[model samples]
Target: MIGSSHAVGTDAGKSVENTFTLDYQVSGVSQGTITNDSAYTGGAGDPSPVIDPAGPTNFTVDRMIDLAVTADNSGLVVPSNAQDRILQYTITNLGNDHQAYSFSIADVAGDDFDATGLEITYSRAATDLNGDGDTLDACEAEIVDAPLTATVPGTAAGSASYTCDIPADLPFTVELSGDIPDTLADSNIDNLVLVAETRNPNAWAVEAVAPSVGGVTANDADGTNTITGLAENVFADGTGTSEEADKDGRMSAQSSFVVTSPDLVAEKRVWVLRTESDGTACAGEAVPAVEPTTEYPTPGACVLYTIEVTNTAENAGSDAENIDVSDILPENVAFVSATTSGFNIPGTLTFKKADNTTNCDGTAGETCTVALTGAGLAAEVGTTDATAQLYIRAIVR
Candidate 1:
């Protein structure tokens, strides 16, 4: 109850960076020939013609699963002590087959802005109506919806703090394993869709029909979305845009929130000059100074006021600017003169602005007695001045 011909099939799980080999043999009674001329006593003719072709041949499987990531902050200014600072990131799957990733984005220290109360969540981009591009074309805004499955736990229900694997004690200088971008390219369909637009498989391209045929959702992020679950699909020959996952062609997405704010401190006192015999307490310091108090000087004494303004170290690659400060002098004092430290305004006060150069005006009794105006009052880090400290001294009569 059997046949002469037979077929065998084998299932090799997922695609990987490896090759395989297969070998087999078949034997049966010989039906070809029996050459016995009988010139000799003859031999024991066992007519089982056995044939086994060259084997151990190599076989290559191209079922691949790769991931990639991209981080975008949209250049949003997140002030210090700010809340709900949302950062949008897109994770793309560049592999021809479906994939899964343990997504992550950790807050690194040393930027002067601690990633305090750092949290993470995910969302799929909205549909693009332009029909030219993916998410961005439609709703590039932070339209965060529930992930295929939530990995940040309670975050899906409400804004919740993220669980960081990196310990707080870790030194800032140490580049830990849990860095900003730690995975492969994924669901940002634009990469492949654009490439598939031309439909020319790159020099490394090695498939038939592209997985990009899925278009925007070509790589539907499945599972918890804390990871990727890619849908495996082969690309077309010479037109394939499929990438190799194990060969640094994986995918990923990452983004971070930044907090920035300016801190301004003002100190008012009368600069009382002290000679050698003035007092032992003032002898040690050369500069004229006054004791800090609610009301230090009589109406006749010259009142020296200092305004010190600075800002928290803004996020890296960020600029702190457009900061202005104003003060109201005491009713007993009259504005006399004001000057800035060389640390900030080393050169003469130009009062230069956009296509105009002007001077500040206001007497001591005026409500705007001493106020920093124009662009001169900026906490510039990588700008015209190297010093972040802007010193302003105003003496009132």
Candidate 2:
């Protein structure tokens, strides 16, 4: 009549047995010992008298559904106004049996902004085909179906066959993809949570689905009268920090998105674009790199100035927009023509009067201006560097 809870390390469906023995003494004198089953030969008394069954007491262990989730990247760097930004997580089946899981991403309260179009995806085959260090490509990790099934780890080497796809006790990688809102300044943060619920591997149903919802009730129809001979399911999922309840067959992990902004830095230098012998400026000889620092430019000489604007910001959400670069001409110099190079977007180069109110033709007492609209300067993203150069050719008065 002794019982104990199942041990944790015991294999699912394994047998657990217990037997009892009774020792009697007559008038303070030791008699003989009788066992509960006939299989015990060492007992001196008639084994049939106490034999409860032909064999020892035994019952198969029931399956325990448990899981754990961890965000692969603690801080996911996301660009604002970007679509399908990926947040990766790993879900491990901690229980003794194979299980499928349904995933969801929820916005955490007290955060900066919420993500839009939240979707979950994973890839058992062809993960990260584009070699971009992530499975965000269209052809990679194509499985978007809910309740992603897991295979029991098998002895096979490849996933081409049925048994090879078995992932017993192995972890599955899942992606939570969403779109970031626009106009989010740098360092703004959005806390997000990814939840995973356990499901019946073969039935494609939630393991903890309530009976009122037309799902199987826990411990089967017999309830507490569980027949020790048969296997049953016992929900053992842990409560998570992100509002997950214990033994409810669900778990969750948290991740975040910090909005990043573009940091633009502009550097400008001037040189006298002229052949030293004469006052006439030459294109090949007097480039912007060869600035006239030691010797000042002669009168009527062209003072070539080059302004280089570089988007130094890394992981910027969007490109620098509505950009305007201007330089006021000194009274001792006359405004000349302006041009641009190394610019991905088209811009207008104009000269303005000293008052900065009206546009003026390249003439004396004017200011040089460059106006860029509609996708101005590109942000420094990934391997590409963003730099735009403006060339101004003004004459010494």
> Which candidate ranks first by TM-score, i.e. highest?
2
> TM-score of each candidate?
0.25, 0.47
Per-model root-mean-square deviation over C-alphas:
25.7, 21.1
lDDT per residue for candidate 1 within 353-376, as digits (tens), equals: 122333323243433234555433
lDDT value, residue 57 of candidate 1: 29
Residue 130 in candidate 1, Cα distance off native in Å: 23
Local error of candidate 2 at residue 66 (angstroms): 1.5
Q: Least accurate stretch of 10 residues (summed lDDT) in model 2?
A: 157-166
Off by over 4 Å in 2: 1-8, 18-52, 124-168, 203-227, 262-397
Every candidate's lDDT: 0.31, 0.59
lDDT at 181, model 2: 82
Candidate 1 stretches with Cα past 4 Å from truth are 1-61, 74-76, 100-102, 109-113, 125-144, 147-258, 262-397
